[model samples]
Target: MRSPTARTAPPTRTPLATGWGTRVLVVLAAGGVAVLVLPLVALLAATPWRDLPALVADPAVLQALRLSLLTAGSATLVALVLGVPLAWLLARDDLRGAWLLRALVTVPLVLPPVVGGVALLLLLGRRGLLGSSLDAWFGLTVPFTSVAVVLAQVFVALPFLVLSVEGALRGADRRRALVAQTLGASPAYVLRRVTLPAVAPGVAAGAALCFTRALGEFGATVTFAGSFPGTTRTMPLAVYLAMDSAPEQAVAMSVLLLGLSVAVLVVMRGRWVGGLPGARPPRSGQDAR
Candidate 1:
């Protein structure tokens, strides 16, 4: 020991761990969190606890709740069916005009909900564009109907699914898929057996996000579908309508929506960041060990 001793390197400090950096970062982060959380806190404080049960039990509330669940579920289903393939295509680096396509897919994320509704209406309304032909030939009128609610939800929620899946596909390891292809396996077989399993977590996360987004859809649904109870009145629309007449009911419905959203986020924690505990994909060189 006296003859030879190895020297060890000192630990390095992260940028935010030095001097006043940590304190400043903490203060700013706290402010941002407070901005986001205080409204929910106030909502809880203003909720009429005693009347909550009665408010939720109202027929109109029940109808809106049921319709919201149905349309959101349907929209999620549609997104899974349509968005997944688009995501797969988008993930390919070789695809032409991918940037343009991705921008179009994400347009709804930034576009005003009411504007999206107007666009949908122009395309599907009884007298506009293809709507004229649809109505004249098939006797179908889409606007101000429950079908319109589902369509509106789909327009907004589909992007979430597509983006989530595309990210997952891009990050997934492709060696296994390539190896399968080299082993006389068909591309379809490799995709079904090797590719999809690696990205299942992404697909599930996308579906959950899609469902939640659809559940909260409001402006587009209201503008294009019109809020008719038991037909197109989703929970958000119900809350808006109740605000003018019965604020207590509106608060109660809001609390319910808040609870559902929180539950979904809790269940999906760590998924969007990486993967669930037992579901995380192996890191590079991990398989060799």
Candidate 2:
């Protein structure tokens, strides 16, 4: 008889209940969701739905809404203009002190908005470090103006754009860009035709995030720009003012903001912000080889 064939036992999977690490992860995840979701639920439940339309229709609210959108849009555009190049440098270049540059770029993310506003005021106030010179030379004033609102929003929103675009650049396969350059494409042409397309998803996500952040900015705008109707008083500042004098209007505005956030997330889902990656084509049943 032939030698008996050797046999091996199949591998076994540990059940979830048997894994303390998995149990801890599940608990943590549950807690995180609860902490985030509960507040939103409470806010929605307390919303004054019956009078929302009228509240939002107030002239004061409308003025704030227009100013907010305008400033946020301007800020987002500025972020894109500056952040894309910075992102490319961060991802692809080997400049000296790159780490320091990145740290500086990201500082606003962790810095308190009020602190950032203070710093801006020191830099741009009429009698401030740069502002004094500007005032003396150009007769320009930045602080407590509409321009100040845009500046504050740009300061806070720029990091989001740079980080997102840099990550996308790092993740993208560089072979295509290299090949384009080798094929005599100019650097600008290559960036526009090859690099940007590869990272469009990240760019879109970054822009959305940047715009939303600018829209919601309060502390920096309040401090640096001041709440002047038809000038620097954006929606957040309006909401703050309303909360003190017109709680119902404040609730309505808050509800509107919540709705906008939800809508953005919903519309932006898939490839850009998140959801799922594209699926590969199904394999053929048979291979000739």
Pairs in clash, predicted candidate 1: none
Residue lDDT tens for model 1, 1-289 = 5435765544444565656877899999999999999999999999999989998998888888889989999999999999988999999999999999999999999999999999999999987888999999999999999899999999999999999888888888899998888889997788788887898878888888999999999989989999887899899999998899998899999999998888887888656545322344434443323
Which structure among the candidates has the greatest TM-score? 1
Candidate 1 residue 209 Cα shift, in angstroms, is 1.0
The candidate that achieves the highest lDDT relative to the unseen native structure: 1
Q: Residues 99-213, candidate 2, lDDT per residue (tens digit)?
A: 9999999999999999999999999998899999999999999999999999999999999888888888877779999999999999999999999898887787788888889
> What lDDT score goes with residue 53 in model 2?
90
Provide the clashing-pair count of each candidate structure.
Answer: 0, 0
Q: Tell me, what's the RMSD of every candidate?
A: 4.8, 6.5
Per-model TM-score versus the true fold: 0.89, 0.87
Clashing pairs in 2: none
Lowest summed lDDT over 10 consecutive residues: which window, candidate 2? Answer: 274-283
Q: What is the C-alpha lDDT of each candidate?
A: 0.88, 0.86
* lDDT of prediction 2: 0.86
